[model samples]
Target chain A: MILETKNLSIGYSAKNKSKILQSSLNLKLKSGNLVSLVGPNGVGKSTLLKTLCKLIRPIEGEICIKGESLESAESNALAMVLTQGIYAHGFTVFDVVSLGRYPYTNWIGKMTAHDVQIIENAMASVHIGHLAHQSAMQLSDGEKQRMMIAKALAQETPLIILDEPTSHLDLVNKIEIIHLLHQLSRQHSKAILMVTHELDLAIQNSDEMWIMSQEGIQMGCPEDLILDGRLQRLFQSNQIVFNQDQLHFQRNHLLSKPIWMKSNSDGLAEKLSFQLLQKLGYYLEAGYKDCQLELLSNQTWQITKNNSVFQFENLAGVQDFLRNN
Target chain B: MTIRILLLSILFVVLSLLSLLTGSVWISPSEIYEALTNPQLNVVNHFIFTQLRLSKTIAAIVVGMGLPISGLMMQTLYRNPLAGPFVLGISSGASLGVALFVFAGSSLLALSPWLLSLGLGFFAILGAFLVMLLVLTVSISIRNSASLLVVGIMVGSLSTALVSVMQYYSSPQLLQRFVVWTFGSLGGIHWNEIIVMTLVVSFSIVFSFGLMKSMNALMINEDYAKGLGIKVNYLKIKMIVLSSLMAGIITAYAGPIAFIGVAIPHLARNFIHTSDHRKTLPIVLLLGSNMMLICDLISQLPGGTTVLPINSVTALFGAPIVIWIVIKNRSFLNS
Candidate 1:
């Protein structure tokens, strides 16, 4: 195991008072594995990650990195990518990324040839090599995030931790970042852990999952955790429900009357019609005698109910027709 | 980068020479060179050159090098562009210390001049240390850099007000002395005072160089710096002490020369085109020294017999540069 925490309790302590966020965290992360920590907001996911990175001291228990106590492990043993953005002005992407060599650089921080090579490799790994000359402040959020990840990669530690790496990114960028981290774990054999709100993406990409909630901590493979209903319990709410088969979340909407859906072609119009109906809180049956909906391949829709038939050119028209009827 | 550094070094030499030649005395460049090279030939000119202009030039260099570097450290520590020795009231704190001692009466002044200056230096450091402590404490509670800046301004106002109350209660002689000190003269420092100031500033600069790596890490984010294994609190305290010492010592000698601390780092960053202190620190040092020399030259008022205050000269020159930087980098500042 690259990292293991036994009976860890994480929280803030000031003066004579201490507040514990989570306790009894028995976690293990191995090389060549990507793990995601998912939990409800304020469930101490960040606290746990911070404790693991040694940014904040744990109130109780022990954290071991590569069989050594966390306190004994050098700072270069673990790399961290934080959520807070860089505030340093006028720094280029290369300058920011090269700072990862802080541990190896001399007192004046003169980068060695080997350190420069690692920096280049890191930027290339994140596909930001072309942007090395560009000022970091001018980069888009997604690009900046990738550069930050490259910095962590340049640290060349056995373990890497990221806090909400994909929080502000668009869907494509989010997938891209998670995919890059996933590849890093598999190809480089680095133990990677990320705190994320992207549940489906995390579940799909992560080899293991650490779910934190009111029930404390549950650790296992994503699939196992899903099967055991651990994820469901962690994210359960009045308005949203976790869909195990779909590997995503769906709103708990009130059900409408069931309708039969039929299509002339198994194409875009057919799939879109079913989605529209489901979104309108209607359940589709394979066939129903009293109510039937037909989607023609010519981008038309027809609804037949109780011996009446309505024809419309588009889905919106069909919705209007249904509302009038 | 090498070319830029070379150009800046050349500019620094030319400015230092110009400062030496452009005083109230009508000494030509050749005569000044001769006086510098052959000190035995002209005793009166030698006194004017060494005791007056040379000391003033060294004082400017020391103040220039010290303030900008201190400003750079404070800016990085607070992550605020406007943070500097003067803006954050560190100079004012030094002023308060000096004011208390100088206005206390003539008994202390009756002692040896060297002893008197040393006493003032000690008080200035105490005052600066107190203000640094207060600013750091307030910064802990306040996350916004701009708000901390406001707090600093408030602290400066309070110190100035305290100085004013002390001035009002003092004799006319003491009040004039305090007012002239506030005007900030570079011409009055002797070789002994300049040596002490140089030593203090050099120590701080060397200490800051050692902190370049941690400061670079800090620029990214504090948590990231910590994650990289930087001892954040230890580095912070060290920076505070170093910055205070530099600013305090310079203020004690130069009477709180303004704006160089706040402006020079920005100017250096613009010239160097990078915020990485590894590259920016040297540029800041050279540029700061150059700026101080230029300000001192302008303060001499060229054809006039009366010399202008160094503080006014620096403000007139420094404030506009700061404004231009703010305008040019509006987006970066907002970010």
Candidate 2:
């Protein structure tokens, strides 16, 4: 366990009484564990990360990293730490990443060739090497996010904390970032604690998911979350329904799919076929991509794809159409 | 190119030479050289060359270099394109200090020129220090750069008004002396004061040079500076101290020689078109020194005859160039 938040009441006040989230948060985030702190908006996820980084003074909490308390650490003498996507000043990608060594830097802030090599390596790790000379503000959204990751990597922190790491990314960008975090966790032996609202993706990609709910913080595997029927409740609203068995959201306006055409393709084909079905008003399977065309609900799509041939859901319907034609 | 720096240095040297040779007492170049080397010709020509010209010439250089570097610091600190040592009430503080002592503090202008002028320098520095301290306090307290700049200008106006009141109370003899100081003469600045000004300006220049990278970053925003782990407060405090000290001392010696401090940095920024402090600092120093020397030389060209105040000439020549820069870079200013 690189990090342990002991009774961490995190907020920004010198006095012990003005804590925003007062709870005994005890968790050991170790290497090879990708943890997502998923909660609704404005639930002190950012505050917790800020507190952990000592950017915000926690009112009544002691964040013990490795073995020492955060307050005991000297000016910027924290055991390796990085805050993701934080902008404190304008610097070149090279300049910003070089600051990860702020604690190690001398009075003159000299960067040796060895330091330059480390900076280069970090930039390459996050794939921002080409942007070395570019000003930070000029970067695209995805590039900026990657640069932040590079900065964190440059810090080489054992425990990395990110607040809303994927806040402004599209789906592809979100997945790529998650994939990068996963790689860093595994390869670098970094304990990654990311705060995000991305439920399905975070739960899927992370080795463990940390849930911040009305019930309190809980940590469990994705499977346990599904089986325990706890993951579905986080985003359940009056207009939407959650399928505990399937571990996904179902909107109220799904339509049924035709059967005979859903019997031909394999797994990848099933997804593409399901997408094609969705475009063509055909329904997809709830949990398994199994080709089962059944009357589940009126105006709701009980979709079917590829059949007994490949055992695909949406693909089976397309197969059925080929045979009929 | 580094060669351009060489060229500029050479040019500064040549100008310094021309300034030495072209004065009213036109001894031959050979005679000047002989006076520099030989003991027979040394005392008479050396007195004319060293005491009368070299000190004033060097004082002009110091004044030139000091104002712009101080201006550069002011510009970066306030994040204001127009902010400079003079515009920020520092010169007014110095002017007020000089006015108070020379005019109101005494009645004998002819008898005691040097001794009473001691208080002039001290009061000037104090005024400049007060203005800077007020600006620094307001900037930190308000947490807004623009408001701080406005407050500095307001303070300048207030100080100027107070100096006027001092002038109103002064005797005729004291008023003539005070009025002469207000005209901003580089003449009669003691060799020692120029040496002290040079040392103080060098300290400021070095102080600014040390914060080059981070100050470059500061041109963006404070938050961005923090991300790079730059302790912004320490940097700001250090910079304000250096700039105020430079402005205060220069004001003490040169009687609020205006526009060079305000204009030189803008010209440097224009020359580079980059926020790089490394490139800008040297240019500000060189160009500022050059501009000040030229302004002082032109004002003392025997045609102005009455020895026009360096402050007024600097305004006449410097105002348009700086205004042009501000208008051209208006977009940058609004940010």
Candidate 3:
């Protein structure tokens, strides 16, 4: 096990008093594992991560790293990636990554040949070797995220913790980062943990999932959590609900405005129109007389409502026409 | 980079020579050589060389090196581009010390030149240290850097207010003395005070180099630095003490030279396109020294008997460079 916490209580302490957020928690993280911590807002996910990183003191209990108490472990043995983006003005991608070697470098931080090799390998691992000399500010958000991950990799620690690593990324980049993290865990045998709001991606990519709420935390494999109904209770709201069939969350509202959907051919276009109508809060039906949508194979949508037929070149046009009618 | 360092060194040497040659009394190179090697041949030039021009040159070098380095440290410590050495009220503290000495302590001490200089430097350093101690105590309780900045500004204002009230009630002769000191001169420091300033500035700057890596980490992000096991608070306090010592001692001997502290670090960053202190530290030191020498030479007005205040000359010379660099390289703001 790379990390383990026993009966841990975390919170803030003032002059003579303390405010405890959560207590009596036992957690374990092992090598070659990718764990995603998903929780509602204000559930102390960040506070817990801070406590693990030793940024703040835990109100009670013990956190051990590699079988050693946290306070006794060598500080160089642990590494963390934070949510805050760096200014990185006038710094190249290489310079920023080289900062991860701060623990091993001398006082002046002069890089040895070994350190140089490690930095190069880190950049190559993230596929940013081409951008080694480019200013960090010029990279796209996704590229910057990769650079930060590479920085943590260069730290050469057995364990790595991240806070919302993919918070600012687009959909494709978000999945790509999670996939890369998963690969890093298995390939390098490093224990990787992250706090994220990407539930679907986390379920798909992480080896284990930690679902946290105000009541407490539940840790298990993604399938086990879903089977035991733990994932269903992760959020407390009637407007949103966990969909068992799709393995994701969806709005539980009574989908209004029943509209019949049809197409000449059962292909990508027809399936897309069907999904779109269902997503826009319309109860999708087949062969209904009152309202009808005919998605043609010629990239046009025909909507028949109240005995008036409206044709459009796209799904957006169909939505606009239906809303007006 | 090596070439730039070499060029800066050459320029510094040339400027030092020019500054030595450019005073109210026109002393040529040969005459200077004679004054140094064969002192008996030209007694007047020898006295002027060792007593006036040399001390002034060394004083300019000390202030130039000290202020910008402290300013760079301040900017890094606070993670603020606009921070300078005196932002924490060190200058104001030095001023209050001088004011109290002129307004009150003058009657208590003998009017000998040696005693006056020693007393002024001692009291100014004491005042600066006292302010630093108060700031250090307050900083222990305040975790936020912005709040520390606010506290520093408030302390500066409070000290300035006290000095103004003291000025309003002072005798005319005493007021004139205090006002002249505030105008600031690189020429007023004698050999005795110059040695102390040089030693303290050198020590502080050399010590700063040892922490350059930690400073870089802190500048990137404070919490991240903490997670890396850096003692952030200790680093901040060390920076504060070093900056105060350099600013305090220079203000005492040379009367609060300005512009160099705030502007030199920016100039280095603009020219080098990097804020890595390992790279910029040497550049800032060289540029700062050159600027001081240039400003002092301008103030002296070689052929004329009248001299301008060093404070005005630094602003007049430095402000335009800053404006030009900022306008030309607008990305400096990002750095």
After superposition, candidate 1 runs with Cα above 4 Å error: A242-245, A285-290, B29-41, B329-335
TM-score of each: 0.96, 0.77, 0.91
For model 2, the DockQ equals 0.13
What is the C-alpha DockQ of each candidate? 0.82, 0.13, 0.63
Looking at model 3, residue B315 earns an lDDT score of 81
DockQ winner:
1
Measured with C-alpha atoms, the lDDT of residue A183 in candidate 2 is 88
- Alpha-carbon local distance difference test for all models: 0.88, 0.70, 0.84
> What residue pairs are clashing in model 1?
none
Report the lDDT tens digits of candidate 3 across residue range A271-309.
678677777778876778789888766588888888988
DockQ of 3: 0.63
lDDT of 2 by residue, B1-335 (tens): 47757777887887777666655565567877887888565788877777877877888888888888888888888777777877777788777776766665454444454554455566777777777778767766774445666787788899889878877876777778667666677777777677777888887787778887777656655644554567788988788778878888888877778788878887776665545576778877887877777886677665334566677789898889777866865665555
lDDT (10s digit) by residue, model 2, range A201-288? 8867998887776556778887787677777667677655664555666654455654333334355544554555555555544545
